[model samples]
Structures are given as C-alpha cells and as structure tokens.
Target: MTLTAILPTLRASLPEPVDPALWPAHTETTTDDVLVAAVSMVRLAELTGTPCVHTAEQAPPRYRPRSWMPRDVSVAVASVLRVRRPRTGVVLLELDAVLPPFAVLDQVRLIGRVSTAAPTRTSVVTPYDGTDGEPFHRLPAPLPADVREGDLLCFPCVSAIRHRDVVEPVRAEVSR
Candidate 1:
C-alpha cells in the first residue's frame, strides 16, 4: 500500500487518507474505539443498532504490497461511488464502473489508475472545445459491445476508490 507518488494530473486526487495496510487483520484502535475481534465497534454499534457489522472467523493474510488480495475486512468497510474532480477539465461517467479488489487499470509503479477491469474501456485525455462543440458523455442501456466514431474516448475522475480501499470519509467526530 505504498506505490503512491501522490498527484500527477489525471485528477480525482485523494492520495492519502488512512492506509493502515488497509485495515482488518483483526483491526484494533482503542483510544476511542474500533476493535474487531475483541469486539467494540462503538460497543457493537450500541448493541446491534446503527448498521452494525463485525465479523472474523479467521485472520492472517495481510498481503497487498502490489495486491494478491488478502487484507480484507469485507473489502474494508465497502463503499463506492467515486468520480469527483470538483475542478478540472471534467470527466466522470461511472463508465459502467467496477473495480472491486480485482485488478486491471494497468500502470501501477507509482500508483495511478486503480480500476479492476470489467472488460476494459478507460482512457483519459480531455480537451475538445473546437472553441465549444459540446460532446463529452452519454452511454448506457445495453450499450457496451463497443462503439466507435474516431473513438478517442476517456472518463475517470474518481476522487476516491482506494482498491487497497474505502470506507474512508469520516474526518473525525465520534464519541461513545
């Protein structure tokens, strides 16, 4: 979990935000609470309430220096919907999105595109305003057998997906 060079233009940047080897090898973090095996996820969500989920029938598989799929706390609390560039040339189609703990966006020497492939259709390089022509996104409804028209397509500004990954958005504010 450390090939990150941080930001390199492609945008969707969220390079660092809690990377404890991607949690759950029996997660434990008590100054407040976050236990797993010892169980205390906010006291099991105040005794089985707020969407509680704590599990572990086995533990010992931290592997993911480049990813072979091991470190998994149910895919680390799971949450997906990442495509945010708030400011840039703009790009975010969801592109039939799917990058769950598998592997496929290629290039990962300094960590950039981390999509796990669904049949490949991700390319990036925007800028077409023949001064202003308008045409950037549109596709869906049983349409992915491959379409073409000079092709040159691209879409991805995933501000956060962390395949090694997410459930990361809780900037601090919790007491129990």
Candidate 2:
C-alpha cells in the first residue's frame, strides 16, 4: 500500500472527487477506491480484474412508469416490446417522443414489467427496417431485455451525465 492509503486525510482530499449522487446509495470513495455497499471496488478489481461490474445489494426502489425521467421529457418509446421476428425472438423499438431531448437514439434500456431488471441495447438498426419520418433509426433490439407485458421503457439520463462529464465549462440552467 502507498503512503496515501495509510493516511485518511490524503484520501479525503481528492482533487476530482466523484459525485456520490451519480451512483447508488451508500456509495463512497476511499483514497484508492470507490466502495459501494461497503465493498471496495478497487479490491474487487485486484482479485477479479478490471472492467468489473460491481452490483451493490440494496432494496429496489418502487418506480412509477415515468418515475425516473425528467419532468420536461415524455416517453414514447413503447410500453411493451413485441416480437418483430419469430425465429430470432427480436423486438423493434420505433423512437418517437414529444420532446426532442427525450427521443434517445441509442444506449437505451427496456425495463422489466414485473421486475426492475433492464437490458441494454443490442444492435444498430438496418436501413430496410428504419423509418423515413423521424430521426430515430429503428433498432432490432436486445433478445432478452427483460421485457414484460406492462414493462414501460425508460430513457436514462446517460447522455446528459456523459455530456456533463465530457464537456467543460457547462452552464447550469436557472429559472427565476
């Protein structure tokens, strides 16, 4: 271990401390690692290897259909997924939303109807399948995206978060 690991003050004084709110509850940063649910992420990486996904054990929040989305955005990504092709068990999502910012083109998830399990996007849309009407290129989606009968689709603010991280000198919108 390094000297910084030995001293708590050095760890506490991070030049670029990660925002805890960006992650799950009970997430904290040590000098050398981020801990979720009291498990050390760095330690896990040392044992298991890097690019490791650490799932913190926590009670799932009871989310309404539009619970996680922003007030300005409206979801039109379809409530339930339908099998577009029988053999492959494929589902297609035609993106059409009331708001421009809400019409997410990629990196989307189909939240489980019965459970909170969500699957990430699988493939890019082919030209024959897409629509000329809207900017969205229809996606031939994740085979097992935990899609259920009443599972509503959600657009996580991943892009906004990414923009915040990647872009510099950002202006926070303020209203009087």
Q: Which candidate leads the pack in TM-score?
A: 2
Local accuracy of candidate 1 as per-residue lDDT tens digits, 58-142: 3444553554544334322211123333343332333222323332123111111232212223232223425463333322211
lDDT winner: 2
- Residue range 30-98, candidate 2, lDDT tens digits: 433455568664455446432233433232345636445432211122233232332344444422222
What Cα-based lDDT does every candidate model obtain?
0.30, 0.35
With candidate 2 superimposed using the best TM-score fit, by how many Å does residue 172's alpha carbon deviate from the native?
40
Cα RMSD, each candidate: 17.6, 18.9
Model 2 vs. true fold: TM: 0.28
**Collision pairs in model 2:** 113-151
